[model samples]
Target: MVVDRASSTRIVPRDPVTAFGIGNVATTGPTTVRAEQQVSTDLVDHRGRIDLPALAVLFDHLGGLPYFASDPDGSPCVQARLAISMQGGVDVGDRLTANAELLMHDEAFGTTRVDIVTSTGRICSSGTARNVAVGRTFDHNPTGDRGAAAPPGNSDLPGLPLPPAIEPGLDGRVIIEQIAAGTRAAGNLTELLNGRVDTVDHPLGTGVRFTVGTEPWMGNVFGTMHGGIIAAAVAQGCSFAGQANAAAGRDYQVADLAICFLRSPAVQGADVVVEVTPVKIGRRVASFDAAMHAHDGTLLSRCSADVHYR
Candidate 1:
């Protein structure tokens, strides 16, 4: 499902972020987009379920399409806020489809909703994104050739090397320890984006800081860190931090996550630091606050998430 940009007057450049994160997508109308992919080993977490960061990438990709499609000038829009809630579960080998619709829009901003459903009609996840026009316009014909090269295929994108496999049924804390000790990988999505759990401290109960290296594959069409990747880093930080603070013999899951993009981080091989701080740690539920910063200390994004104990 290559993007059907033929009818449009603009040529959106192909970037590695879209190539790797969004695989294949199609636009049904000016206000809707659809994408499909199969759950593979690289898309699953240690528990063999789809990872939240992977869902964030898909949400960001499809959720921005409606805004792009409705704008006649093809002006670029950056996501101002993104929120997602996981309702169901999906695992490896499941086929998934995402449908996105434009919920509302005005001159300066637009809101879009996307729902990811499995083959059995289960709603795996649902999310909404708010995007604001950046006040910049693209060339009517940037390539000067309407018949420009097509988007890159899978072969053209960089492959995510599988991390060292971990033993099955390991609890979250054990996995975190293994990751910290360099004994196990930090799952597929983290490895794909060069994310690392750098430090785990017990200050104020528990605090976790992770770093994601700025690689070319993590850049958006504008050459900055993709909003989805930023959200992914935040999700990773919060999840690990929550695990570090969870009670023994108990497990937790992210119930909801919201992210606000304050600024974009340049993809210059520097590390984006994500610091996770606990807001409240309850027996039934927990809340966390995460902040992402550039290597030079410039704040990039802020996120909040809720985790439910099980």
Candidate 2:
């Protein structure tokens, strides 16, 4: 894809849009987008920590926000891939900032560089995404229906109101073992979940409490947790949830996964508690909601997933 040299000249600086205690503003050029925000959170988890997944969405959006704002036309772009790497952990009252710049572009494709930093001048995360310009202006504005909405099944409580008890028929240990085995086959899956996760008395569908490991490759640059790992945990939760509600031996495929960060879990000595509950059970499709919390019981992130069982 070719970067548009002519598009960069039609740039604008707009007012910051503030919501959920964060303010975001952007400046764009024809072929590039850069955005900045002072991260703040009006929402808090049980540990009184700032939400983790919610923050991720905001930061992630900031990385792409400029592309739409500066588009010569009003059309919004569709993200094909989003990759995130966290170097540091952020907390409540900790300011998070992001800069998203277009690295490459053409009529059909665009690549962007995304970075997230904290107020203390620490780089929290860095990543990139490939965007497909859908050839239409963004039809909605942030001030109204087009703006951010609460994630599906999102609630004030950080975790499931009634954590599922270990079921009698399924062996929770075997399910956890299967998960561990599955992750081992995936790149760095062993390191991601290893001894960190615990399987209770129930089966794969049961909830597990995980301790954040201090492996050298573990924590973010700031010696805290990374959102990517958290996503992995949530993915496993959804997989198990869907599998549990499906016919025996059925394979589950994740169709969509969306998470919101409410607070950042501590990188070290933090325990992650996640429970996945099936929301809908159709013959082929299933929906699940997963909640994650820090060891101290404060909510960190929430996930909504759609899975297909075949």
Candidate 3:
């Protein structure tokens, strides 16, 4: 399916996660996709900047477009691995656009690269998404109407509800203990996911256990938790773990994150648990591993992250 970049032809979102997270989307070419969103306060981090995990959600959406474009049968695909690197900062109210290009693909796997930039032409983030075919064909069209484009602004999109309201006074800083105790809110992306830090006993020191209730809005077209949301959850777990291990008076940032999806958890309003463990804590850098599990302890995904201290 060839999409003319100059025409009004756009890819309509079939899932709530994509509609709510990335806003409007379009297939600019046979191998390229574009998405746009005006950053809102609910998308910012404690630093009042666009959250990395939120960007991961966006990456996950745009990254999957090329595979759909290239497949003639519309084979079912799932995210295999995702890696994102932080480049610059983005604040609330900033209009951001993401462009994704297909790198390579085979019968079993496909890889796509995405770059996010602000209206001011500032690069905000970039990443690559790897997806694997599931050996099945879609029963129905999963991409929705490719010829009809939604009206300008996300509010005009039919059934696209407003994002959850962030509690006032939530500055992007997450206090591990406070959030775990339910005394403070993670706000922003975590708030949107209804993520809560939970207390759990583990052999790994300086770790965190996060739980999020899966809602329909968090699901993919298949009615399961979206891969990008899973990635965001893993990122949050790693961020909390790194913060807990950092020395006093030191500041840290998530340098990069990579996650692999092993299983899909149905979004039945059940709680999904994410456990993070410190792999190594160096003077200038720290590494951590995270695992996402169903409430019954079924491992769903795994992630590794690196944090740079300054």
Candidate 4:
């Protein structure tokens, strides 16, 4: 089943909590907002723990809302970039609460800080974002009702690539494809998001390859994982690899994660391979790179993460 993401990029001033699966659970202060999401079975890994990639994107949507409220109908607030760090894992049906604070919002950039905690008040994840005001506003309606106006198609914009367009219309509505004129097709990075795990012996040390399936959930409108999730997949695998190498070693929180999406993966019928290579294992900070690939040896995407090991 395809997820409807028609208005995900509008950057309008409204309640995004309803758009994403998370709910606006509380408001402690003028600048503070809290959201909670009930993790379902589809959102979890094989171990039934919340998938890091899925959780990371959730942080982006949930954390950005309070800051977006600061701008509302003013500047077009867009999440230019974000980074997430995981401290622990959450399971299915677990309620994840995110408390966000608007750090700053100006004509140029917007930033926010978010902390995600479990029911017992365990800090599981933290995030910082750098968003920008694009100087353009879409149909900003607080009621989320455009009121009978034909929404702008992704292709109508000058150079903005539309979200992966699920083609041919599922039910009499045709969604335009988002690839550029000369853009390349790798596989749906999001489709490869439903992750799988298999252990492999390595000459350097022990290696674990993480794989993922496509579709249903964990995909953008284009039907693939988001760039954030691509990076998180690497971090997730390396976190596993790091833990394996660290056995009785120090636990680390991801301090830095970087990714380059070489090609868009297919939306269906493909598996992504996540192979982690430890660049440096130090007493202070350890680093690793996870490559997302196809079974045919195609390099779909890649990411590198730095962790505070101690």
Candidate 5:
């Protein structure tokens, strides 16, 4: 996802969301735009709930429409841009709630802005983005239709790294790799479990399906799966989705996230599963919604997330 006239870069995970370099990550397709309610993803396996920070990305992914290629003829010629202003987020499970709305469009600039609200409806994050037309390819000059002019070159963009004044902690570092790439291999997830869990298969967009036994070390002061463990799973699921839509040779960044807790997951003898669905896919921004459920069909938690694709 090259935005404006920026050079290509990679993405890295910071804390909760995955980001593409500092601004953009390549995507599999174009932005998916709509104001419809869709099933998006399943967040059933998360223990208890996800944190506010992690959940916001889930929402952003869902809000964006799934990207698809169009026929060379008859499709409208237009530039699409997606921007998000994140309101505050709530802490449910280990994740938060991120609220945002799409802003207006500018034909000349080929971009749009959005308003992001928190669960409590507070403004937490906001930014604007610019998008220009990137023309399509065709054979024989395309008999029925014509293509937009190619975007101007962006060969002079500068490197914008994270503020040098800050550094990342160990957990934060692990989160970067986990989310920058897709879900860890089943063996990796099992290694993280230290042999205390078993994984199952549930394809068809269901992200992660696994079972964990109640172990004393896995318990928190609240007598359930520890928040860290739950957060880890949620991060893995969201990260996997990020990788799925990610363009090769770039990293994804999480811009915002929101999560809702439906129920407490049992720490002992219970299993959990995860599912992911995308919401929006802007040139520089991306979003998704996910769910975690127990084996018995209890909705343990729901999450939304937003990311800046680099």
Candidate 6:
């Protein structure tokens, strides 16, 4: 991945069709198209964190939300406080990997810096840009005067806090439930029931929860919940994060995902909880890292996934 250097001119309107360069393709070379397609595909998978440009795409598709920064044309663009970019990882059997994050953004310049991380969660590429709202005459409109203390569009980019249970419709909780419905849980599979929203807008972490019953169908020969069950639970949490990030307006597709089986659960009936951590909230892409654990604090499994916002 090639990250562009952050600069004031970078923010200036280089493209007229799109306002903030949110959809601006930064890297152009012999491999630009191939690399971008790869990144775009990867960001849409459920295995890992989404890419920066993908996030940029989402920002544009979702309306020109100012907190996300935009170019003079009102397209989403990174400001001084943050930067956006993409990174890649390896794909082993049954396992996926990638990384993403929010580096920095310029509140004054209306730009931000972001670093694309690899599967191991390391920065691989980076870039910077600035933004300004030019009126119809191509005049610079001071964006900071509405409420000096407020952010771009003012207020904390109005968003919904993640629900604790798998409550769809209320916030697309039904979709998660549908994904979990037919799936068989290990050990007392019947014990598993509908989920509930655990935390919304978590500062430390976020995700949903469900009650699993110790049923006979849930176990393999070892009499434990199958690894598939754990993986599904973790994946569901990641999906929840995507839905929450999109605010139920747009849909997200998983590009890639990675899950590490840590331990096997001894009991079939237990309160399973999945925690989602937002690694990077880019314009076209969004990433969420999640882990599954039992009520007794047993680390059942951990997973990270990236989603394409469109």
Q: Report the Cα lDDT for candidate 6.
A: 0.38
Clash count per candidate: 0, 23, 4, 12, 90, 77
Ranking by lDDT: 1, 3, 4, 2, 6, 5
* Candidate 2 accuracy as lDDT: 0.49
Q: For residues 1-310, what per-residue lDDT tens digits would candidate 3 score against the true structure?
A: 1113566353433454343445557778888888776565555443344557667777787788788778887788877998988776676566678899989999889999989998898887888999788864444454564212432343433221233343444322335566666665465556666687754445554777878888665676666777877887888777767666666556667778989999979887889999887778788888888899999999999888888776
Point out where model 6 deviates above 4 Å. Answer: 1-193, 203-214
RMSD of each: 7.1, 18.3, 7.6, 13.9, 20.8, 21.7
Which lDDT values do the candidates have, in the order given? 0.71, 0.49, 0.70, 0.53, 0.36, 0.38
Report the candidate with higher lDDT, 2 versus 4. 4
- Give the alpha carbon lDDT tens digit for every residue of 241-289 in model 5: 5545555444555555444444546566566666656676555766777
Encode model 6's per-residue lDDT on 139-200: one tens digit a residue: 22222221122111212122112222332234333344343454212111111212443334
- Candidate with the larger lDDT of 4 and 5: 4
lDDT of 4 by residue, 23-120 (tens): 54555676676667655443432222344554665576545456656764544454555666777766545667788888887767777888989878
- Which candidate, 4 or 6, would have the higher TM-score against the true structure? 4
Model 1: worst 10 consecutive residues (lDDT sum): 141-150
The reply for model 3, stretches above 4 Å from the true place, is 1-20, 46-48, 137-140, 145-174, 199-205
Q: What is the Å distance of residue 268 in model 3 from its true position?
A: 0.6
TM-score, prediction 6? 0.38
TM-score for model 4? 0.55
CA-RMSD of model 2:
18.3
RMSD of 5: 20.8
Model 1 misplaced stretches (Cα beyond 4 Å): 1-21, 137-174
User: How do the predictions measure up, each by TM-score?
Assistant: 0.82, 0.42, 0.81, 0.55, 0.37, 0.38
TM-score comparison, 5 vs 6, better candidate: 6
Error of 1 at 81 (Å): 0.2
Clashes by residue pair, model 1 = none
Of candidate 6, the 10-residue stretch with the lowest lDDT total is 29-38
